[model samples]
Target chain A: MNRAHSKTKRTAFVVAAGLAAVTALAACSSSSGNGGGGGDSGPVTISYGVWDDTQGKVMQQIADKFHESNPNITVKVQITPWDQYWTKLKTAATGGAAPDVFWMNESNFATYASGGVLANLSDKLKGSDIDMSNYIDIQTKAYTFDGKVYGIPKDIDSIGLWYNKALFKAAGVAEPTADWTWADMVAAAKKLTDPSKGQYGIVAQSAPQQSYYSTIPQTGGQVISDDKKSSGYDTPEAIKGVQVWVDLVNKDKVSPSLQQMTDTDADTWFTSGKAAMIFEGSWAAAEFKEIPYAAQNANVAPMPKLDQPGGVSNGLGNVMSAKSAHPDAAWKFLQYLGSKEAETAQADAGIVIPAYKGTADGWVKAFPEFNLQVFVDALKNSSQYPSSMNSAAWQDPIELEFNKAWSGDETAAQAAANSAKIMNDALAAEK
Target chain B: MTSQLVPPVEQGQRRPTPLPPRGTKRRSLRHGDRYWAYLLILPTAVGLTVFSIWPAIQTFYFSFTKWGTFGGHEWTGLDNYAQVFHDPELLRSLWNTVIFSVMTLLGIPLSIGLAALLNTKGLRGVGVYRALYFLPVVTMPAAIALVWKLIYNGDTGILNQFLAVFGVDGPHWLSDPATAIYAVGVVSIWSSLGYNMVLFLAGMQSIPGEFYEAASIDGAGPWRQFFRITMPLLTPTTFFVTVITVINALQAFDLVYLMVGKASPAIEESQTVVYLFYAKGILQGDGGYAAAIAFVLLALILLITAFQFRVQKRWVHYE
Candidate 1:
């Protein structure tokens, strides 16, 4: 009887333990915590998140300067890399644990603004001494949604043809002229490539933003329609433009294959003198400056044209986060960043071309040996990277298919069609 | 149910003081045994509840909601699940996963062959060979991916560079879609080979030497002995390894993610189901849909595991 009773008691205990485990498991979904809302007057410690460690240093300097002016506001800088920045920001934003301020990318601005996460800074800008008119109009509009200014333009970067003067001299070719056409570049590339000696002409990349779209206007093609609906990739001009990139590998053999470029990053190839020419953004100038060969041999020129009757250029700019807690401090910081003062500071860094109206003069003086004048000229007409709703959702799928097309696994037409369908569905889903 | 059927048996031989009254004494002893058993399992149970089960439940709940912009979520019913059917990306990823899973299956026989070689009783310096074989398993997957990428480099890779001496130009191992999946799968097999071999070795060691000796005395060959005795008896371990390998292959993301990041030209050919989940959930901010995908993945695994158990009787001979 005693043993039987003990067994029953043990069974009951086992049942109780199983019940507790299930109960605990069921309770896992509930979350607890209060959001750190900004107080009206107390010591406001705002967290600012930005990508680019190089820019982060400049931001910190600006914050330090702001601290000198406004002692009450303390800003904390959070530096997340480009790959993880937007993802981490969105996750943290949804959880209400986001940094008080964050950097905004043109690609991600629409998604965040549409979701009502950003604060309306239109009234703040209009009422304050921070003049929005001081910056370029296109850049100011890139961060605006529904007629409300959600972000302040910080800086601008445009793509330019970076060439090695030594490579040019070695190949018995003249330096890249400002008025060079696409034909001239091809001829230059052929002259530069000496495959027998392990040097290539250029790095042919299928990247839509930096290289492809930069050449689109040259071929009289726009990446997306102005209304931002329907496919721009299937057009004749765009296809012709894209072919220029692909032909360097497939036809001309002047550039390394797509696989080679992907394996060894194009920039690494350029910096190492393995490639003579590369289409890199002004943002890369500082990195180039660090490479010994780049310091002595590299110089910038505006992108070559397609021999079209009339064509121009454009570029993208940096924008500040709208959901910042320290709005006043952010405005002040952005004002300083856009001032000729910050432009001189950034230009001295030798990595970026300052976006302020008269900032190019400072950069020209800073890098006198290099043709920094080309970047300044390019700024007069460079086109912006197209932006639209569901760009991330649309572009990623298209790029995935495009990679297949590049690999010859899928034809360009087939990939384009598939990409269009995918983009359409993704855009429709957002509705 | 098993606990209820099997009555607890405690022998009184070790204890000298035994004489308390029936009802109260039995209850106290039962409580004491229950307390100790609970104490023994407390840590593991707590850990599972805290880590696995809780998160699983949360994932399920999160699946059925629309996320708010700046925190919290509103219930969105089965919309997230409905969206899954419409997601072409998910379909492509699932197809890719199937191909990868089938490719990784080749690792099993390869591991068995390796285990068989190392299990040879008189093999000299077997320990060093085993260590070398097991290196990939212990090394970080990221490091393995990076090193393998360099080795597979089209131009300057050591593999291709070596091939050039023999007048053989190696194909772009990772960049070519036709070869990319196979190349990645090869790395996956290499990484898991050591772990699977170790498990097989442990199972092989547990088998008595007398069986082999007895078979030898009967004039039986190694092949005959392996087929008739060794193979049948190794069923349980084989089942465990197969189940684990299948689950691991299903969840293969890290190697693919580390090797071919989002910007890689080979991403289309190399993406796995979990990689798709990560891209959509974390990268794209579609958490609800991602949660739905997760649950679907979980259900698929459970169904497959159940199917495996159902069919085990056919091939898994229990000695």
Candidate 2:
């Protein structure tokens, strides 16, 4: 009787303990930030959100200038890495508690702009000395939607061939020139590849957007038609452009396998000297410069042209949010950013190739150890990434199949055909 | 007896005894005692409403409306639900989630094995072993995933290097689609093993020693004792663990999201249901569709839980 009573007590104790354990787990998972808003209208508590790790200084300086002009305004710079920035911003936006101003990108700008999340800056910049026309045409167009400008153009980044000077000498190859054609690039990559040493000729992270998207224009293919209803998915030129990277992996054996690339990010691989060359945007210049080896050996050159020239050498532009509460202040901040003063500061920081025409001259002077001039000349032939309604939805499926094609799961022709259908279906659905 | 009957019967009776009723004082005392019991439960009841119940109701309402940027609601009934049904990506994610849950379920038997081992008498360092095993459970998820990611690296990871000794090449565990889900599921299982083991250990410890002592006296082997006595008695703990584990697996998000992000080539094969909802609600700003997906998830969880409860009647040994 005593043993039976103890057993019953033990069972009840275990049940109660388990119940308590489960409840504690639920409480820990659900508890989050208190719904506390920051102080209301004190010192102009502007939270400037940005994604780039290297450009924080340039951004800080811009904020400092804003503070100088309006002594009452206290700007705080918040840096969210590129990957987490968009997701966090969206969460904050839905909560009606987003940062006062956050950096925007072309891919996400249209969605946010149309969703009534951004503050319209058109009227604020109307009679100001900002002179929006002074910025690049494509840069302004990327942020303008429904005849309203939602973002101020901060900077521009176009792709360029960043080569290792040491690798060129080792391969007994001459430095790439202003007029180097596609044939020249392939030959140089072939010479530089050395598998025994765990080195590859080029590091491309196996993305159509990163490696093949811009190259499509070189092969005389448009990414999106004028109507934006049809895509350039199945065009022979586009397929040919994509095959260049695939051949690099399969035929030339100069690029890492899809699995190898997946294991190691392309930027890290290039900076570590595992790959002698890479197609990189000006945005990476800061990161590249920080790598000890790259600082000593790397130099930028314009992207190789086709045999007859005239391919699209396009790039991405930075945008700002439209639903920003501080429209006047944000616009004023953007105007200062667009000014030669801000562009020069950015160049000196080795942050990016300024979109303003003359600003890159200072970039070359500031970073005299590297050849930054090549970036300036490269922009002449550059085109912007396609901006059509539903591009994000369309690109989602297309990019997935393209990756499969590169990994040998599907042939290039089959992948392209399938993606074209997916793209077309998405576009049709949008209509 | 008089205290229980007098209060109710007196209302119908024309007249009570002129003397003080025998049960009146006891009945009033009982009422006061029950009121205090309710007061004791008040804090917990209020907390549940403010936290759990309110959020659940709000999530359901949010599903039927499109959220404005500045935080107002505009209802668009069934539009979000329609979109969720048509989304191939969401469907693929659900399939992946089921696969992950099954893979994680394999950890249950493994935990039982550990529990049985730890339950052994005269085992030295059992406390130390249990604490070491539970290390992953207490560590932050991001830290755990990162360490696992390095170990799973194809070129320089310790796992691949160790495989080289056996004349085998380890596949890219985190990057290869064929093995990525299993690889992540392995981490999930590893991290959760210790917590589950402790529960099992506690349950095994609770079983009366006399049953095992009697079985041994009757010449039963260890396996026989486990099957006949220990297994039967540990059923309640097993039921609770299984329900919690399945629910946890269905809601899997952090490991997949952090280790294999959307831009990853392998993401197509790795995304779970919550990851899909995150993409729609947070990434793509389709809150309505995201909310619809959430409701689908809630329905799935409810149905599965109910099914588990129904099945428990056949197998669960309460005694």
Best by DockQ: 1
Candidate 1 C-alpha lDDT tens digits along A44-151: 666677888887887787677666776777777889898777767776666555676667767777777887767677776765656677666666777788788877
Model 1 ranges off by over 4 Å: A1-43, A307-340, A361-369, A408-431, B1-29, B32-51, B61-91, B219-229
Q: Evaluate model 1: give its TM-score.
A: 0.84
lDDT of candidate 1?
0.71
Q: State the lDDT of candidate 1 residue by residue for B103-138, as single tens digits.
A: 888898888878888998799999999999999999
Best by lDDT: 2
Q: DockQ for all models, in order?
A: 0.22, 0.18
Give all candidate RMSDs, comma-separated: 6.7, 7.3
Task: Mark the 10 consecutive residues where model 1 chain A has the least summed lDDT.
Answer: A20-29
Model 1: docking quality category:
incorrect
> Which candidate has the highest TM-score of all?
2
lDDT of 2 by residue, A1-431 (tens): 24434344434333333323223223322322213234434555567778876677678887898789877666678898977776677667655556667777676676677767777778877787666677677777777877888776766767778888888888898988878887788888888888788888888666555677768778887677766678786999878877877887777888887878778788777878888888887666667767888888888777787633333333333344454455455565666666778777877777766666567766667676667777676666666667565466666657778888778788777888888888878678653
C-alpha positional error of residue A277 in candidate 2 after TM-score superposition, expressed in Å? 1.6
Candidate 2 residue pairs in backbone clash: A117-A323, A118-A322, A118-A323, A119-A322, A119-A323, A119-A324
